[model samples]
Target: MARPVTNAAFEALLHAAGYGNAHAAFARQLNHAGRNYGTWRYDAASVYWWLRGRRPAEHVQATMAETLARKLGRSVAVLELGFGAGEGTGTSIYPASAGQAIDAAERLWTTLAKHIRPPVSGTFDSGKALQAALGWRYDLPDKTVSRNGRQPVTTGDIQSLYALADHFTDLDRRHGGGSPHTRALMADFLVRQVALMLRGNYTDVVGRDLLRAAATLSGQLAFMSYDAGDHATAQHHTTVALRLAKAADDRLHGAHLLANLAAQAVHLGHARDAARLAEAAIDGAGRAPAAVLARLYTTAATAYGQSGERRACQVALAKAERALDRTGLSVGPRWVNYFGPAHLAGAALRCLGDLHLYTQALRHAPDAITLSSQNARTRALHTALIATIHARAGDTDAACDWGRKLARHAVGVHSARVEQRVRELTAMLSPQQALPQVSEVLYALSTVPAAT
Candidate 1:
C-alpha cells in the first residue's frame, strides 16, 4: 500500500464526526500523556484503507483530529489529511448502472458461499493494543467468540444487503417488536448475510461502512430476540453485532449493542450482569452527545435499580440528567434524536415507580405521560405505572379502572414486558373491594400469565 495519501477523504470523515486536525492532535495527546506514540501513528497501509473510506477505531479517529486541534489552537478536519478521488483506473465497487446493483448482489452472495465459519472458543482477553485499536476494553471477559456457520462475502452485495436489512426493519416495526418467529428468522438471515460480508472482497473503506450499517441492524435483531424471550438467540445475535461493530471500528454502535445486552440481562433477572453491561456501554459511548448519553445512563440507572443498588441507581440517574443537559449544548446524532427530555423523564419516572418511590415517581409521571410520543409500547408501560401507583395508594377503584384500561390496550400487542406489567397491576387489585372495576380487571387478568 502507498503512504496514506487520502488526506481529503480522511478530513471529510473527521468533519462528519465533528473534529479537526484529529490525527495530529491525537499524536500530540499521546506525547503529552507519555503514552505509546505508535498508536497515534498512521501507516501507509492504514492510510490506504482510510483513503478508500475505511475508518480507524472510532475513538482513535475522533481523537486524532481533536488532538491536533488542541495543539494548533485551531481546527482541521480528519478527512483533509491526504485523499483524492478515484483516478478511474480500477473496477467500481459501486455499480455504474442500475442493472449492476442486482448483478452485484447475486455475485456477492455467490462468492460468499465458500468461506468457513470462524471456530468457537472460550472467551479471551484481547490485549491493550488490540483493545485500543478496537477502542474498547473491559476488566472482565464475559463474551463468547463462536461461529454460526455463515457463507462468504463478495463485492456488490451491499445493495442487496441494504434492501434486505431495510425490509426486515420494516417488518419488525409493523408486525410488532421481534416476535419469536421474527427473531428466529432474523438470526438465520444474519448468520447467512454476515458470513458473506465477512468473506466477500471489498475496498477497506467500503467494507468498514457496510459493516457499521450491518452492526446496527444486527443489534436491533438481537433486541428482537430478547423481546421474544429467546435469550440464547439474543446472545448469539449480540456477539455477532459486537464482531461487526469491531470490524467497522465504530464505538457508538458497539456501545448500543452492549446496552441491548444489558437490557436483556435485566429482563432475565440478572440485574448485576445488566449493570456491568450498562457500565461498558457508557465507557464505549465516551463523549457522545447529550441525547445519546442520557439514553445510555438512563438505561444504566434502570439496571442499577434492578440489581437493588439504590445509591448506584440514583447516581446513574443523575448522570443521565447531566447528559440530557448536553442536548441543549450540542447537536445530537440522528440515531439518538428520539431521546429527549421527555423520554428521559418518562423512563426515570417509571423506574422510580418501579422502585416504589411513589411520590417522586408521581412527580415525573405527568410530564413523561405528556411528553410521550406515539410509541404504543411506551404508552402502555406508562399506563401500567399509573395503575401501580393507584394500587399502592390503596385507591382500589382508581387502580382497577386504570388496570382494565391497560389490559385492554395491551391486547394483540406482542410484548411480554407489557403483559407482565398488566399482570402486576392485576395482582395488586384488592379482592376485598369487590368493586366492578376490580372484577373487570380480574377478568382481563384471567387470560394473561399469573406471574407477570
Candidate 2:
C-alpha cells in the first residue's frame, strides 16, 4: 500500500472552514449543499478518495466547491481543485486562440442567461486579473476569424453593438444601477442579441471590433452591478469582460476594466486590492490618451487614500492632475468620455475626503456639481459627499441643505451606493434631524435598504 502523505489541501481547507475532522465534516458539507450521490457514503469512505487521487463525479465536485465557496465568501471553481472535467453547463475557459475565446464566450453567455447552478468561474483575484491585464498588453494569442458560421457578420453589425453598448452606458448614467427594468433589458440584449451576432461569421477586423464591443458591454454590466451594490455579481461579470478584452487583443479596454474593478474594490474597502488593480491598469495602458491616464491615476489615488497612505495618495492625485492638464479637455475615447477636469475634480473630492482633507474636499466639490446637473445618478453621489463635507465641518444647516437636495434627487434613483452614502450622511447628521428639511429627508431615505 502506498503510504498516505498528508492531504494538505483538503485538510487545510477543512481547517480553514473551522472543521475539526474531515470525515464527518465533509459529509455534513455535502448534505448542507444538497449533494447526495445515491447512497454513496460521504463520510470516511469518500474522505480518502480525493487524497487517493480519485476523481470525483462532476456534480459532486461542483457541490463540494460551492460548499467551500460559501464558507470562504468567494466563488470557487471545481477544476482548480484538481477535479476532472466539470459538468458545469458553461465553459470557463479563458481561451488561448481567438476562435476558442469566441466559442467560450458563447458558452458562458448562454449558461449565465439560463441561470444555471454553480458559478462557472472562481472569484476575481486582483493578482490574477493584474497578470491577465499585463499578459494582454505584452503577449496576446494570434487570432483568426472563422468564416464557418451559418450567418455572416458585417461592420454594420459591429457598429450596432457599439451603439447598443453606448445606449446601456447612457441608461446606467441616467438611471443608476437600480433600474431593474432597464438592466434586465440590457442583460437580455447582451445574451440574446449580442451573443448571437458574436457567434456569426465575420472577417478578422470585424470580429475584433465585435469582441471589443462585447467587452465594453460586459464592463458596463459590471459597473451597473457595482452601482446596485452587488459586488460578487459585479466581479463575476468583470472577469468575463477582461477575458473578452484579452480575446480581442484590446489592451486599453482591459486597462479600463482594471480601473473600474479597482474603483469597485475601493468602495468595498479592499484598499490594497484596489491599489494593485489600478497599478495594473496604468501599466497596461501603453500610452493611452490623457483622459484615460488621468482616470487611472485618480483611481489609484482613491485606493491609496483609503489605505491611509497620504503621501502615496497625493502623488497619484498629482499624476492624475498632470495627465488631465496635458490633455486639457481634448476629447478622449468614447468609453472614457467623462474623464475631464470636472470628473477628475470629482475624483479628487473623493480622494481628499477619504484623507480627511475636508477643506480640500469642499474646494473640489463644486467642480463636480456641474456633472451632477448633467447626471442625476452622479448628483446623488455628489449631494451625499457635499452633505458629508459640510457635516464634518460643523455646518449643520449647510449639510441639511445638501441633504434636502439629495433627497429630492434621489426620489426616482435606485442606486444602492448613492443611497448608502446618503444613509451614512444621515447617521452623521442624526442629531440635527429635528430640522424640518432634515426630518423630511431622513424619512425619505428610510426606505433604502442596507442591502443592495
| Top candidate when judged by lDDT against the true structure | 2
Where's the lowest-lDDT run of ten residues in candidate 2? Answer: 86-95
Q: What's the lDDT for all of these models?
A: 0.57, 0.72
- List the candidate 2 regions with Cα displacement exceeding 4 Å: 1-104, 111-131, 134-139, 145-147, 328-331, 372-374, 434-437, 447-452
Residues 255-300, model 2: lDDT tens digits: 8898888898888788998998899889888788888898899999
Candidate 1 residue-wise lDDT at 224: 58
Query: What would the per-residue lDDT of candidate 1 be over residues 141-246, giving only the tens digit for each residue?
Result: 2132222223334446666766676676555433345355565555445544553454345556666666666666666765654555545545554555565666
**Top candidate when judged by TM-score against the true structure:** 2
